[model samples]
Target: MHRPACSSYLHQLRRRLLLLVLLSAISAAQGHADEFIYNSFSGADLSMDNQASVIDGLLRLSEGTDTKGHAFHTFPLDFSNNPIISSNTSSVPSFSTTFVFAIISDYDDLSTDGLAFVLSSTNKLFSSSAAQYLGLLNSETMGNESNHLLAIELDTIKNQEFGDIDSNHIGIDMNSLISNASKGAGYYTPDGEFKNLKLNSGEPMQVWVDYDSERTILNVTMAPLPSTKPNRPLLSIPYDLSSVLPNTRAYVGFSAAAGGIPTMHCILGWSFMNGEAAALNYSDLPLKSIQQLRAGRHTYKTIIIVCAVLLPTLGIAMIVSATIVKVRMMNRLSKSRTTDIEWEREYGPPSFTYKDLLAATSGFNDKMLLGRGGFGSVFRGVLHHSKQTVAIKRVSPESKQGMKEFMAEILILGHLRHRNLVQLIGYCRHKQQLLLVYDYMPNGSLDSYLHTQDHSTTNICWAQRFCIIKGIASGLFYLHEDWEQVVIHRDIKTSNVLLDGEMNARLGDFGLARSHDHGADAHTTRVAGTWGYIAPELARLGKATKATDVFAFGVLTMEVACGRRPIWVDGANGEPVALSDWVLAAWRGGSITDAVDTRLDDYVEEDIELVLKLGLLCSHPSPNARPCMRRVMQYLRSDAPLPADLQPDNLLRIGVSQELRMMSVERPMSCPATTITDLSKGR
Candidate 1:
C-alpha cells in the first residue's frame, strides 16, 4: 500500500509539471491562429455586470435569494482581436467550451427558475425582463433573425412561454428567446447507464459544448461530479452557427432570471477555445475547492449510490407501495367535503396549483386583469409549463349564485368541442378562490368596437363584421341542434361573442345555457338573459326554448348590422326605443336604408336589407314565429331562400308605385344590376 501511494504522488507531480509547460505554449499561440480562456474565479479576470458579483470565490450572476429579478455576467471577448465564425467571413471557425456550475435556492421545498450560457453580439445584461424571458431576449428581439445570439439554457422551472420540456432540462435557442428544442436533464454513466439529474437540486454539474463549422453541428454533454466525461455526448444537434453569429465577434457570458421562486446561479469554473481542436486535460483543472464541496455532500452521495445498487431488488415492492399511496391520495383529494373538489374530478381538466397561478399572473396584479363581468374578473397570465398565454377568470368568492353558474359553465363546455366556441383549458381552486383558464382572445368582445365611440382604434371592418355574424350563427346552431343534446343559450348578445386571433367569432358565456332532449317540451322558470336581447315570450312566461335563443340572435343580428345596441336612446328626444322596433318601422315606411349605420361606408346594400328583414321576422312577438337556428344560419349563408310567409310584403313586394320610386331615390337600387361595380369599388 505504501509503495502504491508513493507512485501515485510522483505521477501527480509529473502531470502538474507537464501541464505548466503545455499551458505556456498554449498562451503563446492564443493571440495568433487560436484563442483560449479559463477561469477558476478564485483569482481571475472576470467582467461582471452591475447585477452580478463574485461571492465566496465563485461568480454569482443572480442574488442569493432574490426573486423577480435578472442578473448577467459577460466575458471579455474582444471581437477586434479574436473574431467569431460567420457566413460573411472568409473561413468559419470551430469552437468548444466547458463549464462547471451549481444552482441553489434558499427555499428547497419549491423549485426555482434557472440560468443559461449565452453568446451574443451585445454585452448588455438583462436584455429581457425577469421570469420566463430569462434575461436573454425581450419581446422586441424574440424570433428576430437580426439579433445575433445563441444560448444553451439549463432550466430548472418549466415555463410554458419558453416551451420548456420539463422542470429540469437542457434547451437550445437561436436568435429567439424561446428554445427551438429541449430534452430532459440527465447524464450517462461509464457503463452506459442513464441517470436523471436535477439542476435545482443544489448540486454541481459539469457541461461541455462543442461546435463544428465543417459539419454545421453542435454537441452538448453533461456529467455529475466525481464522474469522468461520458464517451458520447448526450445531445448532438446540427446547427449552422455561422448563419446566426454576426461577422463581428461576440461576448460570451451567463444570464439568470427569477420570478416568484428565486435561484442562485453560480459558475465555479469555465474554459473556452475559439479556434482549432485542442486536447482537454481535465487533470490540469483547478478543482480542489470543488472536490471539498463534493466531500461535504458525502451523505447524499452514499444514499444515491446505495439506491442505484438496490433499485432492481426493490423495484416491484416500491412500485406497489407507490401506486397504492397515489390512489388513496387522489381519492381523498378529489372527494374532499367541498363542491370544488367534486367539480374538479367530474370535469377532470388539468388542475393548476394556486401557487402556480400566483406566479403566472404576478400575484394577481391589477395590471394583469383583462376584463370583468357579472360573475368574475378575467386576468391574463403566462403558463410556466408551455409558455402559453392564457386568460384566467376568477369567480367572486362571496357569490353563491356565481359559484353555481361557474359549475354550470364547466359542465356545459367541458365535453363540447367546436372552432366557434371558447376552449376550457384548465382550472384552479385554493381555499376561497376559484379560477378558470381559457385560450386568450387577442381581440376583445364585439361590444367594444360597435359601442365604444373610439373608431380610430377599432379593428373590425365591414367584411369582418359580416363574418362574425355568420360565425356566431354557426356556434348557436351547434348548441341548439348539432351536439348530442339540445342546448338553449338563454343569453345571446354581442358581449357574449368573443373574437379569436383571426377575428372569427366564438360564442361563449354558457352559464345560462341548459341542455335538454330534442322534441321534448322543456321549460324553465328562471328569469335569466340580458334585457333588450331577451325574447318577449321569455320575459312574460319565464320559459327558455330554442325559439327564445333565436329571438335573441335576431336582436344581435340587428345590432351588428346597424352598429347600435339592442335598445337605443334617441339623442334628439331622451326617449328610449327598441332597435328592432325602429328598424321595423323604417322598413314599413320604405326608409329602411336610413337605419343602416352610416359608419359602414363599404357594404352591399342588398345584404344589409336582407339582414334587417331577417331580424324583424325572428324578433316577432310570438316564439313560434321565429325561424329555427338552422334556418337562420342557412339564410345568412344564402344557402336557401327566405320563407315567403315570414318575408313581410313591405320588405319584398314592389308595387312599382310612388313608394318604389321613393325607396330607389333614397337608398338606390345597387343590387343585381350594380353588384360587380359596387364590389369592385368597395375592394
Candidate 2:
C-alpha cells in the first residue's frame, strides 16, 4: 500500500513535468503552437514553440546511428515525411488548434527509446541543458534526454523513474527531473495559481489539449478509440501543472535518455498551429470555447423548428407509409406463420409479418435459436434496419399452444421492463407470423444449469442458488405486488427463468399470467401451467391470482433444492408417490427431512427445512391461502417468521379432485411472439 501511494505520488510528480505540454495545449487552443511544425528537427527555425526545433540533419534510414554515443545520430526524418511549419502564423481555430504526428520506428536494439511532445519556451534543440545532449542525454550507447525541454514523451522503454507497468507508452517531462525543468516538482501558474492534468487511455487514443494562457489553464483529453463521442478534457486536476518552465517563451521538443542500449521510434508526420492567449481562462468559459459556437443558443431553436415544421410533415408521411407497408408486411407474415394462435381478447388476432420475422431470425438458422418452448421454438434475429436481435417465437403450425393465449400475453407483457425481467426490446405484428425481439439473453434459462448434464447442477453451489432464488423472487414480487397492474405468472417454472452470465435470473414467458388491481377481482381462468407446478385451487374455481405464481415458484424452488424432476412415477423404494404428496405426508409425520435432497447434506439442516417450508407454502391447495412471492423472499432473505402451517384436511377438498388431468390446453395460445392467450379460460 505504501509503495502504491509512492507510485501515486510519482504519478503526481511526473504529471507536473507535462505542465508545459498542458499549458501549451491550452495556449495552442488559443492558437499557441501554430508557428512551428513538430518536424523541425533543427533548433533554428522555431520561435520557442512546443520545443519544436528544425534539424536539417537527422539520422535518416540509410544514414543511421548504431553508435553508443550522440544517439540522435541517424534516423529516417525525410523533411517531407515529418514536416512542421516553423516561422509561420497559425490560422487554426482557437478551439481546434492541436499538433498531429504520425510516427514509425524500426528498432536497432531496445535502445531505451521514445518520442516526446514538448512545449517549452525555447525552440532550440541539440543544446546543453540536463547535460546538453539534444534531447538525448549522456555519452552512453543507449539513450539520452535534454535538460532544456519541457516535453511530453511517449516513451517505449523502462527507465529509473517507473517500471514496466506502462509498456511502450506516453509520459510528461520537464528539463532533467532536476531543479531547472520542473520547479517545485509541481505545476503553478506564473501568477501562482494551480492547475493539473489527468491521463487515461482508450483505443486509437485521441488527445485534445487546451491551454487558456489568459488563465494559464491547461486541460487534456485522453481517451482510446471507439467511444461514441469524444470525452471532455479533465480539468481542475489532481496536481499542479504550471511549474515546468520558469519562462513563458520556451520551446517544445522530445527527450529520451539511454545509458546502455539504443531504442528507436520516430515522428513520421507532424502538424502545428500558433496560438494566442484568450481573454478569459479556458476553465472559466462555459460557453464551450473561445471560438464562436451556436450550440448553446441554437439548441432549442433548431429542435423547435424541426418539430414545428418538419416533424409534423414527416410524421404524416411516415404514418401513411407505415399504414401501407403494414398491410403488405402483415400479408406476407400470414403466409409463413401458422394460424394456430389464440389472439389477445382486446387486440384481436396477432398480425406479425412473416418477412419481418424471416429478416429478424436470419431465416431461423440453427444459430439464431433462443430456446424451445412448450408451444414452439424461439429464434433470435434482427429487425430490418434496427439490426436488433429479437427472440422470435415461431409457433409451429401443429403446436398445442393456441393463438388467443399468445395475444393475452402480448397485451400484458409488452409494457414491462425490470431489472430481473428481460427487456422487451421490440415486437412485430405480421398477421399470423408473429415475432418479438427482446434484449437477447445469451446465457440460457435456469433449466440449463439445474437440468444440464455438463457438470452444471453440481457446480451451482449454495451461493448461486441463493442468488437465482432471490432474482426470481424479485421479478415475481414485481409482477405480483409491485406493479400498478398486478401480474400473476400463472406458469412459473424453472425453464421460463432465464439466466444471465452472472446467473441472475429473469422471470420470463408469462403465457399463463394475469394482471389486476386493488379495485379488480382476480380473473377466472382454466387451470394452466406445467403439470407439476400449477396451483391446486386453479383447477376448481378457475381463478388466477398472485398466489398462483407463489405456488409455482415454491415448486420450482423445491425442484432446485431437490435436484430432481418435480414429479416421479414411483418413490425410490418403488411405491406410487408424487414429490409434492411425498413431501407433505412426511411433513405431517414430522419427517420433512425425507423430502430434502440427499446431495444438500452440506447445507445447514435449518436451511433445508426453510426451503421445504417455502415449497409447502407454494404447494398450498387453496389460492386464497397462499402467501405472495414477496413474503416468500422476505422469509428467504430476512428473519421474517413463516405463516402458521395450514392443515391438510381442508386443502383443495372441492376442486376437480374427482378427475383432473394436466395438459388441459383450453384457450388457444399463440406463439410467445404474437400473443399470450395461454392464461385465459379453457374451452
Candidate 3:
C-alpha cells in the first residue's frame, strides 16, 4: 500500500523540524563570554565618564548651558581589548550597538546644536570646539588629513554653515562636520511606509546601529520609545570604515554641544559589542518591557520545542500561500492583463488599464506601430476616456535590459519637468510586459526627417532647424551641468530627439541616462549607448564621462545641420563618410557652406558654417579637447566666441587624428571613428 501524499509531506516536514530542533539545542548548549559593554546608568559606578552624571536613571552627556566643556570615556583600546574596533588586512571586525537618547531644547521650541557618537583613535575631546563643531574637532584639527575620526550625528539644530539638510537629520561624518551620507529623521513601517519621528520631541527614542563588516553595509534602525523595533531600517548605506579609521585601536563615546539655543543631551541605556554580536532588541529592554520570572535551566528546552512545532507549520503555510498566489497570477496573466486600478492611488500616478491600451492601439496592430528600438516598440494610441493622443512604448519580454530602461525612464523622466525633455505620464508593469506612456510627437523622431527619403514631406526650415539645434544644446546643458547631478544621457541621437506640437525639439529616451556626482571621477565597466554616439575614449577605458555625452551631442548637432546620419554612404564614391569628416573636409576646402543640407538653400551662409564648425569641435576624438555642454551652449547662442585656432587641420589633427591613432574604436582611422553597438550588448 502506497502512503498518502499528505502524510508523506508531513513526514518530510517532521524530519526537517527535528533536525532544526537538534541544531538549536546544540547552539543553546554552547556558552561564550559576555564581552559586551552595557550600562543602564542605574548604579553609582559611573563607567562611561566621571563628568557624565547618572541623573534620573539616564547618562547626561551635556546640560543646556552656554559654558563650554568637554568629557570623554575611554578604555584599554588595543588588540587585547574585548570590544575594540579593529581593522586588519584579512577582514574587519563587525559590531552592533543600541542606545536610547534624548535632546531637549533649552529655550521654548528651539534646540541649538546636537550630539554625536564618535569613534576616534584618541580618548580626548576637542576642548575648543562647541556648538556647530559638536565637540568633536576644532577648525585646525578638522583641516588635517591625519585627523582620523568617524561619527554618527543625531543633529537637532541646523548648521547653515555646514550645509545640513535640516534641523532634523541623522548623518554619518568622517573627520569633518559635513556629512558623507545623511537623511531626515524617519522610521520605516513593515508596509514600507516612512513615518517621520521628531528628534527634538523631548521624548526619548531608541536607535540601533548595525554594521556587517564583511559586506561593508551599515544599517541604522530607529523607533519611538515604548514601541516595538521597526522591521525595516531607516538608513542602510555602504561604507568601508576600515579605510577611514586610523588603526585597529579606537575610542567610542558620545559628544554634545550647546549653541545659542542650548539643549540637553542624555543617553538612557547603552550597549556595544564586537565580532558580529547581536544587540538587545528594543522590546526586551527593561525600559520598554515588563520583567518576567524565568524557570531555571528550561529556557533552551522551551525555545527548541516551540521552534520545532512552529517552524513546520509556518513553512507549510508560506508554501501554500505562495503556490496559490502563483496559480492566481498565471490565470490573471493569461486571461486579462489589466493593471489594478488601486496602483494609481498607491503610487500617485494616473493609471491606464492594459485593456484600455489594447483597445486604444487596436491590440497593438502594425498600423499603430510608430517605431522600434533595441528595448521595445513605440505605438501611437488614443486614450478612450479623454480621447487624447499618446505614444506608448511596449517593452519586449525577451529584452532583459528593457526592464531596467523602463524603470530608468520612470524614475528620471517622471520627476523631470523641462521644455526640451520628454514628459513621462504613466507606466505599466504587468508580468513580463512593461510599458511607458508619453505625449505623442506627431512629427515622429528627428532621425526620419534627417536620414530617411521622407525628408520631402517634413521639409524642416533652417530657422526651425537652428532652433532645434539650440534647443538640444540647452537640454544637454541641463542634463550635463544644470540639474542637481550630472545626468549623462548616454544615448543622444537624432532618433531620441522628438518634436512637440509647435515643432519645438524635446530630448527624450533616458533609458541609458546616468546621474553622476559633480566633480567625481565616474567610470562604468558596463558601457552603454548607441554605437556611433559612444565617445572614442569609452572604447579604450570603458568609462562614461561627461565628455562622452558631449561627444554624442556633437554628433547629433552635425546630423541635424547636415540632414545626414552620423555615418552615411557618399553619393559619389559609394564609400561610407562620417558627417564630421565630410564637414571638416569641406571646411579645409574653404567651402564649408557646401556641407549644409541642399534643402536649406535659404539658410544664412555664416550661421550654417558656424554650426558645422561647432559640430567638428564638439565631436573631437579627444575627450578632453571636447567643449563642455555649457560652453557648447554659449558658443551656439553667440555668448562666447569660438577658439582662434578653430581651423580644420588644427581641430582635426591634434584633437581627432592623434587621439584616434591610439584608440581601439572599430573604425579607428575614419574621421569621427565610431562603432554601432546596441546599449543592451554587454561590454
Candidate 4:
C-alpha cells in the first residue's frame, strides 16, 4: 500500500534518526570541542551546519563594545534569518530555534553566576548575562535562594551537597532556589572525558540549546570547553520557551537567577534556525521517543521511513513558505512619507545606484568617510539635487542586523521631521547597495567632544555646554514626551548624539530605538541599546520605557557634566567608587564640587550642584522614582537641591559598574583579516 504522505513522512524521519544514531556511534572515536560551528555573530545561517542540539538557550549577538557592556538575544529566526523580535509576523507558523543553552563559568556557586533566556510574545527582545542577573527580582541579592526566575544551573563545584542533583547538573527553576521544577531527574552531567567541569577557571565553554514554540519544549547539550566535538554531550532537558514567551520577544540570549548559593555559567556563542525547521513532539510522536526507537526493527523501519519523508517535506515547506514570506516582507517596504521625489520611488536604499553615491562620496574614499559603527561605514556626500552636502551611512549589510535595520532607519526617519532628530534625506534600497542619506552635522557627534576627536570644541565653553545639554534634553524630551508617537532612543550614547555647526545636540541612529508607551516597559523581551548608557532597569528587566530612557539620560548627563565618556570614571582604580557612585558620595559629603567638569572648576559651586543633582536624579535606582523630562527641566533650570538620597549605589552593589573586570567585553575585536569580496571590484 502506498499509504498517505503523512505516514510515509513519519517512516522517513525514523530512518533518518536511526541513520544519525549509527553515524554518531561510528564517529564516537572523535573527541569533544573538535567539530566547531563557527558563529561570529555576523548575519548568517544560525545552524552553520554544525548539527548542535539545544536544550534551553539563545544566540550570542555581539553588541560591539558600547559605552558600558554588551550582550545578545536568541529568538525564533525570521524568514530572512533575522530573529523575530516583534510579534508582527505571519501567524500560520511554527517557531523553533536550534541549539539549547549551557552557561559557562568557573565559579563554585551557581547562584553567583547569572543567565536567562527571556521570552516575550509582545516585546521582541531577549536578555542575559554571566556574573549577575542584574535586578531581575528587584528586592533580592543574587543567589539568595528565593526569586522568580529560571536557571540552568551548571554548578562546577558542589555547594549544595544535600540537593537531589549533582554538582555539574541541569535543572528547571522558577527564579528561586527553594522551588526546583526538576524531580529526581537531576544528576552530575559528565563531559566526554568524564571530568568535572570547573566554571570558576574563567574559561569558556560551548553549549547547544533549542526551543520549540509549537510544542513548548527545550533541549540542551554542552561541551567542557568551546567547540567540543565527538560526543560532547553532557545534559539534555525538554523545556517550553513559550511558557515565558509572553514576557519577551523572540530574540534569545543568556539570563541567570542568583540567590544564596552563587554559581557561574557563560554562553560563549549561540544561534537559532529560522522559523521552525523541525520540532519533534515526543508526547504525540512514537518516533521521537527513545523508547520507541529502541523498539523492534519492523516498527523502527516504519518510523524511520515516516520521519525521513516528514522531515524532508517539512524542510521543503519551510523553504517555500519562508521564501514567499521574504518576498512579501520585502515587497511592502515602508513607503516614503513624502513621495513627490521620483528618486526615492524609482531607486530606494540598498538599490539606489552606487555610482551616484560614489560620485557624491568621491568613491568611498577615506576622506569622505564620516565614521564607522558596529555594522558599517558612513560618509559625507553632496547630492547634486539642491547641491547640498549630506551625510551617508553606508552599512556593510553583513552585520547581523544590517538589512532590516537599514530598512527601519529609512522608514522611521523618512517619516520623522523634528529639529532635534536627524532628518533622513534619502536611501539606496538595493540588496547589495546599503546606503542612507541624512542632513550632515559638520561638528560630528557628541563623542567627538567627549572622546575620540583630538580637537575639543573651540566653541563649547561652559555656557555652550549648558546649552548643548539643554538641547539634548529638548531632543530627548521630544522623543520621550512630545512626539505623537513615543520613540525610545535605545542607544543614547554620545556617539549616537549628533551636533550641528551651532553645537545643538540632535539624536541620531534610530536603528536601535523602538516605539513604546506606558505600562509596556515592565515586560521588555529584547534587551538592546548601547551599554553603559542603558538603564539599570533594562539590565534587570528587558523592558524599555520612558523611564528607561530617563536612566540613560542620567548616564548621559553625567558625561555632559564631566565632559567625559561614561566608560571612564572618577574611581574604581581599586575601590567601587565609579563616576556615578562618586557623584552620589560627593553629594552626600556636601562637596558636590567633585561632580563638576574639571574644566568648569571656575564655575560656582551651585551650578555644579545643579548638573550633579540632575545626573543623580536621572540615575535613580527605581524607575518610578526617576523624575520625568519636564520635571528634569524645572530642576535643571531652577536650583532644586539634588537628591541626597537618590540611589546610585544600587548599580555598584549589583556589580553592574564592575562589568569590565567581571564581564570584560574589552577583548580584542576580531574582523575579517581581509575583505575579499569588493563590490567596487568592477571599478
Considering TM-score, where higher is better, how would the candidates rank from best to worst? 3, 1, 2, 4
Alpha-carbon shift of residue 454 in model 1 (angstroms)? 3.7
| Candidate 2 local Cα displacement, residue 571, angstroms | 6.1
Top-scoring candidate (TM-score):
3
Output the better candidate (2/3) by TM-score.
3
Q: After aligning candidate 1 to the native by TM-score, how far in Å is the CA of 473 from where it should be? A: 0.5
Give candidate 4's whole-model lDDT.
0.50
Per-residue CA lDDT of model 3 for 1-683, tens digit only, reads: 55698899999999999999999887654322223444455552333432355554556666643323333444523423324334532133566777777766533345646778777767666344666677777756764556677778888766544668777899888778888888898888888899998887677787878877667788888888866678888778888776666476666667777653435677766676665334544443334211111121135336544555565455556557577766565555433312332333233333466888888899999999997876879999997854668999999999878878876776676645456888676776665688888879888777767766666444788888899999888888877766656777788888789998788899999887777678876656665776556677776666888888888888888777888666655567654456688788888888888788877767887778778888888888887889998898889888999998888877866434334334534534322224432221211
The weakest ten consecutive residues by lDDT in model 2 span: 59-68
Q: Which prediction has more favorable lDDT, 1 or 4?
A: 1
**Superior by lDDT: candidate 2 or candidate 3:** 3
lDDT of 1: 0.69
- What's the TM-score of each model vs. the native? 0.47, 0.45, 0.49, 0.44
lDDT of each: 0.69, 0.48, 0.69, 0.50
Model 2 lDDT tens row, 1-683:
59999899999888997897899888755442234333223332323222222333221111111111122212211112113323331211222223322222222122233344555443334332221122433333122232334444444333322222232444444444221211111133445444332121101222344544334455543332212213344222222233544332443334433211222222222233334312222222121220112232245335544455554455556567577666566554443332322232233323245776786667789998766754667887776743545576766545446454455566676545456886544345554445555556767777766666743226566667767877888888777766557887777877788876577788877666677886677775565666556565565566777776787787778777766555644535543234566566667677677776555546666777777777766766666677777678788886697765454444434323212233134532221322213221111
lDDT of 1 by residue, 320-382 (tens): 656766656544543343344344335542347888888889998999999876577899999
